[model samples]
Target: MKALQITGAGEYGIANVPQPTILDDQVLVRITLVSTCPRWDIAMLGGKDMFDQTRPPDYPLPPGFPGHEAVGVVEAAGPSVQGLRPGDRVAALEHLQGQGAYAQYMAYRERDLLKLPDTVSDRKAVSTELLKCVVLGLDQFEDVKGKSMLVAGLGPAGILAIQVARLWGARVIGIDVSPERVAAVNALGIGEAVLADSLGDRRFDLGYDCVGAAPSVQNVLDRTNEHVVIFGVLRGELIYRDRFWMNGIKLESHKARPVTERYRRLLLDVLTRPEMNTECLQTKQISFKLYAEGVETLKRQEAVKICFNPQEAF
Candidate 1:
């Protein structure tokens, strides 16, 4: 088997490796799609510690590593694995301490895989892992129906937030510095999308910040009526006005949940819906041999969602 191996910063290639073995509670999956997580992968490739600050920087990430969002068909199941078979189509969770989904085969705990519905296509189902986070973030807000909500940063998560908030009956507004992103949101026909600088005198009952930068957090705090949800991973300190306390403003931060049966069912229910618009979020699909190129495209902000097809030849 060939697996992706990052030899150093800005360097990677395929290496021949032995296939993974499944444990009693695990299943072997033949990977079909591996989504690029730019923030984590690009930072690691550039020799930075963005994903986990506590862990010291490790060079040359292990073979078949650096991917979390993935979907595949089950090739084999361990004796203890139940409710799963050799032909089940499922989404995978990243095994942080083990080999990941960026390979032809991976061993996953049976509980970590979410079976895809027949109504969901491979392209749409591949987004289940990320969409679960968006769903969880939206679930944190209360009484959103008929309320005004602003989604900051029109990235993939931001766009999904816009759609989910709208479904929750919120009058949604999207803001992004990039015209292309705003245009893409507008194409969804769900809400008003605008340039961040052009949002003059505009405010919302709630604000969701998809970009975790300090500036993005400050922007949401300034324009929100009272409640703001920090949905993205923040890398810097956040400073706000002293008057923030006087206004009784509330701030909430969200992190993706570990895959569990309850959350898996919730995610699959949403993914099977036509309103999720999962396909629109996918921007490009490339062969596994071009994984580095796909990561480069994401780092340059040239694409929104890029998937590597491990089954395809370069």
Candidate 2:
């Protein structure tokens, strides 16, 4: 079994190791494909903490340290693992700790993974892990129907947010600083969008902030008619304006939830939607050996997301 290890900043090496053993409640999955998490991969390669970028990162990121998004076929399942078995096409709907999913095989808790229907292709289902993350925020609101929702960034997460919000019956308006991203959102035809600088007196029933900066959060807090959900990595101290208080504008920070049956169902529900396809976001796919090259592409902003085929060797 080959697993990826970041020996140092900007350096990586693959080593053949014994395959992982499954526990009573775990499943050993034969990985077919794994996807890059731009932020985490960039941070690991840059030798910085993903959450605290200013801090230095530890070297040799626990083989397969950051590779969580995956689609695989279950090779074996422990006795306690019910409802999942060998030959089931699946993806880990949640992050498995130090999963080393970048390898050809990984052992993950049965509860952390979910079997996928044949209708979902590996390329499309590869994004399901992220879809679960995006749903964490959207599901926070009981209902978004007929609401005017502002998506405060047009990156991958924000784009998914726009689609989900729309699917949930909300009219969406996406905003981003980059015209390219704004144009991308507009091209999707799922929502209305405008450049951040071009935003003039635009307001929404609620705002979903995917850009975790002070300006972005403040922008939503100021313009939203009723509520706001902070889904981005909040970095700076935010000031709550008096007007926000006077208007009774509500705000909620997205919370992390452990993977569960509900999320598995949500992942399938969202992926099965014809209007919710994100296949265009997968700009590149490469053999797992080319991870360094893919990260370089991500650093250059050359791709929305890169998929890695783990079964292919050097």
Candidate 3:
């Protein structure tokens, strides 16, 4: 099996590795498409540990690391694996322990895989992890039927936030620092998309800070009327001003909620609707061996997410 590995900072190399053996509870997934996770992919390639930017990244990360989003066919299933068999289409709903999504195939526990509904295509199914994040985060909030929402960043997650919030009946408004992203979101017309700073004095019933930066979080905190949820990874300390507290505003960070059976059903429901735009992150596809080129495209803002095809070399 061929797997991608990071030999050093700003480097990508393909290695011929041993094919994984399936455990009794596991299924072997023949990876068809693997997508880039900007946070981990860009950070790792830049020599920074995404978990702790303060520390230098360790070299030679596990093969197929930092490439978690994937959808593939099950080539084989262990005898103990129930409800799954070879040729069943499945998508990884969670990042595997080794991030082995970058390889040609991976052996994953049945619990971590979702059997795809026939209506869902590979492109839409591939981004279930992102959808799961948005769903679980919004699940933390009270019903948003008539509420207004402020999504503080317009990246992939932010884009999904706007659509999901609207679908749940919130009057959605989103902002982003990148003009290109702003234009892209505006084109979708899912909500009021504009420059992040342009929201000046507008207020919303709820705020979702999708950019994990302090400024973006603070910007959300300043404008939200009822509750603010921090959806972005916490990279810096947030300043909750005394004035904010006096206004009776509440703040909550998104917790990784357990993937329950109901949530699994909800994901399938969302994927069935094209309006949710589950796979909006992807922009282009390249061979798995050319992952470095794909990363460069992401860094250049030429693509939002790159899909790597392991079956093709050129």
Local accuracy of candidate 3 as per-residue lDDT tens digits, 1-314: 89898978888788888988888999889988888887788889888898798876788888888878889999999999998999999888875576567888888889888899788888888877777898888877779889988998887788888888888888988898888989987776656788987877889989899888988898888888889989888777888888887889989889986788998887788778778776667888778667777788888877878887776642
Question: Residue by residue across 104-176, what tens digits does model 1's lDDT show?
Answer: 8888888778887777888887767678788778777766899999899888888788888887789998899
* Runs in model 3 lying further than 4 Å from the true structure: none
Give the per-residue Cα lDDT of candidate 2 at 189. 80
Against the reference, the lDDT scores of all candidates come to 0.80, 0.83, 0.83
- Cα deviation of 39 in candidate 2 (Å)? 0.7
Judging by TM-score, tell me the better candidate of 1 and 3: 3
| Clash count per candidate | 0, 0, 0
- Tens-digit per-residue lDDT, 1-314, candidate 2: 88888888889888777889888998989989888888888888888998988876777788877888888999999999888999999987765676667788989888777788998888888877778888889888778999998889877788789998888899888889888778876886867889887878978888899989989999888888888999988979888888889889888888888866776777788888877767867888887668888888887767878987778843
Error of 1 at 309 (Å): 1.3
Better model by lDDT: candidate 1 vs candidate 2:
2
lDDT of 3: 0.83
